[model samples]
Target chain A: MSSGLALISIFVLAVFVGFEVVSKVSSTLHTPLMSGANAIHGVILVGAIIVASHSDNTLQLTLSLLAIVLATINMVGGFVVTDRMLEMFKVKKKPASSDTSGEVK
Target chain B: MSRDLYDLIGLVAAICFILALKGLSHPKTARRGNLIGAAGATIATLVVFFYGDQLPLKNLPLILGAIVVGLVIGVPAARKVQLTQMPQLVALFNGVGGGAAALVAIVEYLKLGEEAAEKAGAIGAAVLIATIFTVVVGTTSFTGSIVTFLKLQELMTTRPVIFPGGRFVIAGNLVAILVCSGWVYSAADTTSVMVLMGLSALFGILFVLPVGGADVPIVISLLNAFTGLTVAASGYVLEATLLIVAGTLVGASGTILTRLMAEAMGRSLFGTLFGAFTATATAAGTADTRPVKSGSAEDVAILLNYARRVVIVPGFGLAVAQAQHTVRELADLLTAKGIDVAYGIHPVAGRMPGHMNVLLAEANVPYDQLVEMDEINPTFPQTDVSIVIGANDVVNPAAKTTPGCPIYGMPILDVQQSGNIIFLKRSMRPGFAGIENELLYDPKTTLLFGDAKASLTKVVSALKSL
Candidate 1:
């Protein structure tokens, strides 16, 4: 099969997958959801690396390096920020040593 | 790595991205999901170093240096960013990602010289289409996100900046973009591609300028989707499988979220895009002139102690004051006394969706005590005291009773139905949307004028004495 055809098929199928995975998220988690999705698109860093490595001129190297730096920021910052946000939502477990009423409710 | 082996790694990375998003759907798995996504990114980044065609030796230092620089800036910024400024942070990060995608398209175009242009006619139309799409969408997302960052940070006016013939100017930009796209399809040169990117960027700034401050959440979500599509376009150009899947996933999900945000505000997507909520002229002259009762912290405490049940409505003001901890303490005190205490959270309460919930969760408030607007609205009639903290528009009765009001038809917490309403606000200044809240003017509601943290602390102290 042609590379274009393969890409098109993957693109169409991924759209459904994206919708299915995100639709199950509750409203209370929308902020984290946005952050997570933001990080996923940071995959562009791969493309930046590719173009930057092959750059033969100063202009090409500069543009691609800028892309690399920006893409790295998007990837690293997006995931770290998302993780920080999601960590706050974890359900707290009571300490085993506490004898008093430590019930969450 | 060989080409086939590289393809295998890409496939595995794509699956990891899918699993990451799946894990994020539930709070219990969200943190783990984020880690999984990061792992996927790490794998993809590693694979780039092993590309068989590009030896990777020449750019190895540059790539590593760039990664280190990004970590230096992104990590500290993300860690230190206040929860209140999360929207701006997200905008900044998202903008950089879009800028990266646009740069990729530009470098690709510049690399394709006159010799390659003549040979490119046989490479298939898909590549050309993807290149054009990447440049247009990517540049638009880049400029649009920067403007959004400025607006959210208050460095620029949050109000809409519409001028005469604005629509025509935006329309002209779009038409020029179409012409440029056609030009690239035929000529396939760097100049045409640059022109396309510049025009799209201009349109992006104009596109977001007309949106009001209160409606920024929807705009942010929309731009998030745009960045995703741009990445997907670049994925097509690079023939990278993981980018295509992950990008499409983000694009679809962000679009859905943007639409849902508009609906949560009781506005259609069309209305949100064109009829932005706060055009200064339209919302003017709807002054709510009427007598209102005022109360002290002691009075509010007395009312709360005697009340059978109490519901608290938390809004952006609570987050701004960083009073979630105090509010949670107050609720704990009320709950221990056997007086019912529950929170009412509006869908669009804070600067971003679910922002209020995240703030309360950070305070260790039991999730069960936090009730959504739909589920809590009916219970208001049975409550004795409804304490509204730093909230205005979400509890305003004008949304329901006033016909011509700007926020009419937007669903709000039914605080007015309760026997007594106590509002904690700095003054009678209208909400972000600049609509005068009629609920504050109602006789049943009493205003408590003070900072939310100080006011809530006083109320907690007064309740303790009783």
Candidate 2:
């Protein structure tokens, strides 16, 4: 019961933290922010691994392995694609700076 | 490693996730933030191998192989997907994650087996309920995301799919799902659980089918939250603190984003999800075939060449025609002629929020020139020409003028206030919302009919020659 209460406290605090962190995001980064959050939840890969390690039967093992593969894709693909999107934002910034510097010269 | 050490590492990974989300909120810190998240994920995954003695060394090879296969598939797809297709790709990734959570819960349930039924007292019941919630919600998120993906990818009709009695049918499906969920709770039987999963999957498809294309982003955000809650539930069932924190965080954040997106589109969350049921079905193909003022690419070039100020309104169609580069070329030519130009980006411009910014960024458009809706709205009145590239709904005057219409209350780009409105269009088709744009027929508006890319290219050449 004490552990459950601890878990509940964690859940409540996390919710508050989640809202607080993303509440001020400008609309310009909405898509990347979303994609990044999507990747973070892919930490369910840990849950998948825990289950897979404990499976005693063929069916259980197969299911756990499948979960691992899917979770991996969610975590990995999500981060990579988010990075790709953010990369474009980064590349454009450099040229704008250079053009400003050129103007100064 | 000691159990305490593993948990400490997990907590670190969770903090990294919090930082990642915080970092993503700002453009300057976003890339680094994502890197931090990736690093945290790497830490969590590596620590799992050394945590306790639960993982048999024999199963290690299979686990590694599965992860390798996932990497082989996930990395290349992420790397190679077109910017235009990013929304659907994100939806697909989210769907697979939901499926994985469901599978993990199911495997855990199977492992618990009949023994779980005996301990149907408080804690065991809680675990069983959490497991059931994970299965139902995770499956719904998985299937619902796939439907959203199909809509965005244009593999399925982007319009709302409403049958004669869709509301009733959807309601019936929901009731059936609840009933099945109850059965699973009482019996704790494998068949009951499977039935609940199947019902939830059906409910997911039915739930999303009524949502129109414009509202698909909201649906995606909602499903992401659903997946997050499922992960949280599965965490409870498995007693993993990391999953609980990460999942609850995502669930909370995703809910906020969904609300923000819906608000941006001037839509209520409830209305977006269930508007099809309450509204009367307006007839399709009632397009007023009024003769619009069509102009040539040369004429558009002359107008743009002479204009002192221009604002380019971009939409989903710009991305569809892959005209970002061509449009940028036109803008550059206009800028060279001493005409000030800026892109007016609607919040929900493309398939997703900020999608147009990404597409435009890919074409190397200066960030300063990409003005947001609120910041750009007042400038439209003073602008000489507003070139709407393959966009319809965002600039449509009907949003402000016509009440009791689908998009009446939605805030729009006031391109109508410009000296001249020029639309680059392929045809007279209504936009994704299936509503006629009255601004297209305004006397001051000139239509250039062709693929946006081709039309922009012609305009560029014409302006250069002049």
Candidate 3:
């Protein structure tokens, strides 16, 4: 099979998998879901890195460097913000909520 | 690193991305899910660093410098931004991804000259198509996301900016993008490709400028999907497995979210994109002249103190007033009196999807106490008192009763059906959709006018006095 066809197959299957995975996320988690997905696209940074590393000219180097910057921002910012938001939903273990045997709930 | 080793690493990263999404389905595992996704990114970056193709050692400082600058800007912005501004921040972050993808494709295209293109032969077809696709979609998402961020940030008018020939201008720009894409595809002209990128960016601005703020969330989600598609195109250019898998996943999920948000607003995808809610808001503002019964915070407190079951309906106003913590205090006080207090969260209650949930969660509101519109609507009839805080559109009765209303078919919280409703509002203004709420005029509803925070504070003090 052609590599193009192989890529298409991977793309189609990934689409299905994507839909199925996030379909059950409760509405309460939708914001985090979005930011999480936003971060996933940050994988584009790898592409940026490849192009930048192989750049042969000053112009190409500059453009590729810009890509690196923007992609880095997207990757770092998206993940950190999502983690912060999700942390608010976490149930902190406290002594006041401990069981009679000193085991925390 | 060998090709086989890099592929294996990419596969592991892809698996991590999938696990991350799966884990986010429940709040219990969401924090770990985020961390897992980040770990995947770190691993992917590391593998690329060790890949056989040597990026010149001299350029190492430049690459690291660029990343340091990105960290400086991105980290502080994410940490300092208020939760109320989270939607706009998300839009801005999504834009940077698209910008990066577009730049990557552009750099790759520049590396391919006429002789190189000739040597590439049939594979040149794939390269050209991917490069052109990435340029068009990525640039569009980049500029479009900026416009959405501006509208949401209130830097620009949230109302749709309509002109006499606005649709024509947008249509004309889209055609330009198409013509440019065709020229670059067939001729392989480098200049035409850049022109196509410029036109797409212009079209993006025109595309989002006319969309009202209420619709920005859907637009952001759509742009996010566009960014994902662009990344996938970039992946093809780079031949990286993780990028392909991760980008397609993001693209699909973002599309679903866009659809869900549009459905919540009772709009089709196209309609939400072109039809501004401001047009409806203006029409409804003038029609409702009926007097509403106004009450003091003490009066609302009295009704609440006597009630057995109290339901709270919060909207964007609650977020705007930064009153989630105060509202939680009132709920806590009510719970202390043995009153069964619960929250009704409309699906599109805040600026972004699940925005109200995050805001209230930050205030320590128990997840169980917060209920979806479908689940909580049924219990409203049994509710003795329903307090609406800075909410207008989500609880509006016109959605069901007035066929002529723009939001007539939209689903809303059944706050009007409760035994009594005390509305907390700044004025007699309509909601974001600009429709007059029949619920406000209902005898069972009492309007309490003030800043949401101040009014809630007074009510809390009043309950204390009792």
Candidate 4:
């Protein structure tokens, strides 16, 4: 197998495992997980953009630019929204009270 | 321009992904971790676009158009969905990822041509694997998630909708899927592979149908894992760095979640899948025809006000009626009159574990006031009133000693220990597991049958007048 082909094959197989995994997360964590995963999707954007910048072909260039912007938004927006929601879990610190878990310790 | 830059970006992206995952374990830094990871991913994608020579750049509008379409749907969906609805939304999004991966793989395969399919043997293997995974999981998630959404939203019954020959249908679909998967594994023709994908899609739908609403969390988790795998496969087909990392992180996290969900229900992953239909069969021993001892809300409120110590137990009905804030107000008013008020939270209360606690916490209920089932159960006898709000299963006494009861072995809140029990509900409805709550008809129990929000509000108003 060619090195390039091997890389692609590994990538494809990894995705197969990826699908099976995401379908099984706990409900308590979906929002947080999605927010985190969306940021990771930016890696795709960065890679696509990098490919486009160096490519002489118009197709690669356009795909890369488009991927970059979408990836950025998905990543950034996901985080912002997730953070806002997580705030609901945050315990506002009381003076001289340092309880984090808020479980009555 | 240098190769080192791309490598550096990839390394950074990996680190970000790891840190984000770690941060996600704890709620505090999870959002920041998610953002940082996303940034790293964006950088990684940019680096790859610059360095990768294989990216197709010809269809300029196509790429932009896809992004635009994603935005139009994604933005509104994210904005409008409530936190409670996040699970289904995530399922929908994950399905989209798998579908996208499958589409990308198919496009790539067609582009490579019949001549290259054999010439680029290893590439063909990758494409075949990625395309097959993406299509199967994507189609499954799309259908299964829609079903889950319907169940959660009450558009469909929570009961196990068993058909006369459900198992045979599912078995047949599974066999066909296995044969198709085996053929796809051998690098079959693109058209035939696509046809196989259709069979897998049908299989996914049948696989989820027998599963009752009680197992939705597990189903959702499994579907999420499928989506991650599909995205990773798409990454392989596209040869993109971002897709690979993103897919791996999602895949890893999703797998962990599936394992956790199985654990939450005290079952193994395969056990849950193979015997998922058992939840329906288990419904046979449940109490469905039990009657509730109904009372007026005003009378129940008066009784609660007269009590010296009152414990409030909130359930899915409270969440469904959006009554947390009202219940909180009731607690405060009772407290003002020298009543010791506390909330009894069952472990497996509501749709998910700790769901009641989350809702109560959202209403600013003091942590000290919220007691777990174990601690509060023993204290129930000392309490004067135990008020159940939109709850059924957790208070049922059948879970204790009634071996034939469906929830026999499961621990429940000891509302039965209270001298006076008031249950606030909209109707004499059974819980998600379709089990009758024996406590509802107990001699000590008085059901204030009404919508949780209105009932709680009325109770608060009555307490205020006192």
Candidate 5:
């Protein structure tokens, strides 16, 4: 197969994988899940870096640099915020289980 | 690094992303999953630098400085942002990501210049089309996310902004965007591309304008998908397999999530966007002086103290009033009194789907007590007093009873089914959808008009007195 065809195959498979992964998520996790996925696309940082390194002129360099900054924010901030949100869920787990335990007993 | 090594690392990062999404689906593994994704992102970023031949290390210092600046700005904002404001913050992050994708595409397009047209075949056309897709969709996502941010942040009106011939105006803008995209495809000129970007930005703003407050999260999710597809297109343009995989994953997942959220709200995606056009203008400003049985906090306290079962239905108002902690205190007090208390959480309770859960969880409200709509709806009929704090739209009976209203057909918490209902509201004003809830005036309902926090505080003190 040609290189383009290989890329197309990869793209199609990835789409299916993406849909399959998050298909069964419960409603409560929707916010953090969306935020987490939002951060994943922050991998655009790699694209930004490539464009920045390829820049030959001042304007090109400026734009690419700006892209890098934005992409970094998306990636770094997205993960951190998602982690923060998930942390709330983490802390509540033990206490929540204990609270329910009393009733179970 | 060898090309083979770089590609292998990219593949690893792609797998990590898939794992991250899978891990995020459940509460037990969510934080660890996010951490794994972060580690993958860190690895991918670090490896890009070592891939020597393709990446000339010329702009290394500048790029490092930019990344540091991004870290400085991004980390603190993520860390410091209140949970209540998280929806807008997510919108902001999504916007900047879209902006970055668009900029990368523009830079690549500039670098290609006339050489792009020299490649005389289908590959050339494909690359050009990908570049155009990245530019248009990325720009639209960037601006659309910003509009949603403004609406959520209350920097602008959250109501649907429709005007005379608004639909025609939006349709014309879309047509103009398509024409410009075609123009850029034919000419590959910078001017046409620039015009296309501007039109796409305008189209984004106009597209999001007609969507009401309750529907903004869906729009955000859709724009998020748009950004993802743009990244995928840029990845194709840049010949980077990692981008293609990651971007397509988010695009596909975001699309599905958007659909799920729309379903939870009982809205078709089509009706949410274009329903404004078909909707007849309801007379909004006529002050309804209809007598609601207004009671003091003491009266509400007496009602709650005697109830055997109570369900708290919270909305965006609860978040706005910063009353989650106070409400939790009240719930705990009622539990002390042997009243069975459970929170009835609407899926689209706050600005985003599952927003209320995040807000409530921050206040350390137990997860088991936070019941989903379907599980909790059946129990509302058996509950005694349902305390609605700072929430309006999610519990509005009009969602089920009134056709042609903005929230018509949306699933609401069956709060009206409770034996008695007490609303702690700021005023008699309508909900975020701009529709007055008929349930507020029903005889079974009692209104305590004040700030949710203050009203709850009074009720707590009154319950103490009892």
Candidate 6:
């Protein structure tokens, strides 16, 4: 609830937004964007951890705890799902027998 | 003086995210990227529950309720959704992101009323503005994206499904936006905020509904961008640094993807906007579309080996059979015969964009052998052969000559030029684009009915034996 904390949050968020807009024009990093952003989820985790540690107020602590949990899930689960999806791209060698056809003999 | 190990956990998660992203650039390393991201997210969330104080004591039930409800719906949906419908699924997920952003903003705003802006310390006017911006865009992305999913899945019409006085509905949205914007400037309270939120949701729905089904790819991409922006805005409100950074990346990348898809379709952004959503099927007098032509594997196989330039246009059929390796084998044999071989890739070929590319790349087809639709279409006519392995829409002559057809004006593969054409399809079923391929009946087109991989390998054998 402190004005100081609120200001820091807004400034931090704004800078990130600015970074995002700039990155939009730079198309070189298309595939890795999600991965990069996933790391930022860690920042939320850190903030929540800090808040939990700072606030004796049960309500604040609980919320921060929840935020950390959700953020971690998103970061971890998102990466897992995305990885599996990408694996679909890997051409698996078919059973040398059936998954393929023969050269005209 | 406080030892917050939670911060350390968060920092660790962040590092994972970075590694995950770097790993996702190529198929070979993408799994690593995915794993790192998941690890980061998991750690982040666990730390939140263990440390954060945002969830009120009495409202524990609310959070619990949402998790329960979300699991019920999300789990089943994930289980049942097919790979062919994965694009729509992605749209649906993007919608969830928007919904989450809006909800987060709404909850935060509710807290603001209780905390009084003056007492809430640094919650400045800019924060309020950013929060509202995110809510509005997020709400819009949510509704618009769901509608997009419906359209793509054929649960709704693919065309501009305008109603009586549809233009009036749009004008009214403008009025609602003005009213909401006015309230945000005045009362700035939760009641006014709620009304504004309603209007924002309405505006989002209005913006997307009129977009024709033909533009779903771009629309989906745009909605994804909007969700990113919304999350970024929410990050602003929450003062969550990493949230903002992650959200912005999604926004930027999604925007570029939208622009790229738009360009590939030969439509200006404005051109797509002006077109009414139209899902009207284009099947008609074509009841007489040339009688289906059939071919035996041995007969067709002989023609393939003798041909000079051969373009293999892959489709969803290949994926259904999981036949990437077989395709590669066929291509290898042809290449060895000194035949020019290339894979013609349509932008929207297969169920989702880039699917054929993923499948072919898995088969280890040389990167140089993979050609895009634009690069390959022109060469089709001069080619000695075109083996359409599960492709339909892109090669559909209807895109070129048939007006009023569902896929009219869409670009197609110029396979008509090949001296010999072989179409391998399971049946006469139309492609996802919902238009019959006139290419099926071309005198030059010989239809080989079977699993695509089987037909292709059969042809390969004929070529090698001769």
Whose DockQ is greatest here? Answer: 5
- Which segments of model 3 are wrong by more than 4 Å? A92-105, B55-58, B114-123, B187-190, B276-282, B287-289
- Candidate 5's C-alpha runs over 4 A off are A92-105, B54-56, B114-123, B282-286
lDDT of 3 by residue, B355-407 (tens): 89888988888776777888888888889999999888788877787765656
Query: What TM-scores result for chain A when each predicted structure is judged separately against the true chain A?
Result: 0.83, 0.85, 0.83, 0.55, 0.86, 0.49
RMSD of each: 3.2, 2.7, 4.0, 5.3, 2.3, 6.7
**Tens digits of per-residue lDDT for model 5 on B1-466?**
7889899999999889989989998888898889888988898898888876654577999999999999999999999998889988999999999999999998888778745567643337778889988998999889999999999998998899999988888889988988887888787667888898898898889888889999988888888888888899899999899999999999999999888888889999999989888889754445777888989999999999998889999988898899999999999999898788899899988888888888998888987788888888888778889999878889988788778888889998999889999998998888888888888779999999988998899999999999
DockQ ranking, high to low: 5, 2, 1, 3, 4, 6
| Docking band of candidate 5 | medium
Q: Give the winner by TM-score: 1 or 5.
A: 5
lDDT-superior candidate, 3 or 5: 5
Preferred candidate (DockQ higher): 1 or 6: 1
- Two-chain complex of model 5, DockQ on C-alpha atoms against the true structure: 0.64
Query: Candidate 1 residues B1-466, lDDT tens each?
Result: 7888998998888888888888888878888888998999899989888875757547789878988888898888899888888888998899899999999988876776543766754444777788888888888888988998998888998777789878889889999999999998777667788789899999889999888777777887888898999898888888888889889989988888777677778867777678743333564346666777889999999999997788999988898999999999999898788777889999878877788877888888877777888888888888889999988888877788776565778899999999999999988888766677877878888899989999999999999999
lDDT for B263 in candidate 2 is 85
Q: Clashes in each model (backbone N, CA, C under 3 Å)? A: 0, 0, 1, 57, 1, 55
Candidate 6: tens digits of C-alpha lDDT, residues B93-186: 6666566666566566655555676585544677777777867887787788778888877787665666766767888887887778667645
Give TM-scores of the second chain, every candidate: 0.93, 0.96, 0.93, 0.87, 0.96, 0.75
Candidate 6 residue runs with Cα over 4 Å from true position: A1-77, A88-105, B1-31, B46-82, B117-124, B184-199, B212-214, B277-302, B305-309, B317-342, B360-383, B397-412, B425-431, B434-438, B448-466
Q: Give the TM-score between model 3's chain B and the true chain B.
A: 0.93
lDDT (Cα, tens digit) per residue for candidate 6, span A1-105: 684465456446544543434232212123233323332332333333333344444554444445434433333333433443465445554444432122111
DockQ of each: 0.53, 0.55, 0.45, 0.21, 0.64, 0.17
Model 2: residues >4 Å from true position, as ranges? A92-105, B54-58, B117-123, B283-285
Candidate 2 recovers a fraction of native contacts equal to: 0.76
Question: TM-score of each candidate?
Answer: 0.93, 0.96, 0.92, 0.81, 0.96, 0.72
Interface RMSD of each: 3.1, 3.3, 4.7, 6.1, 2.3, 7.1
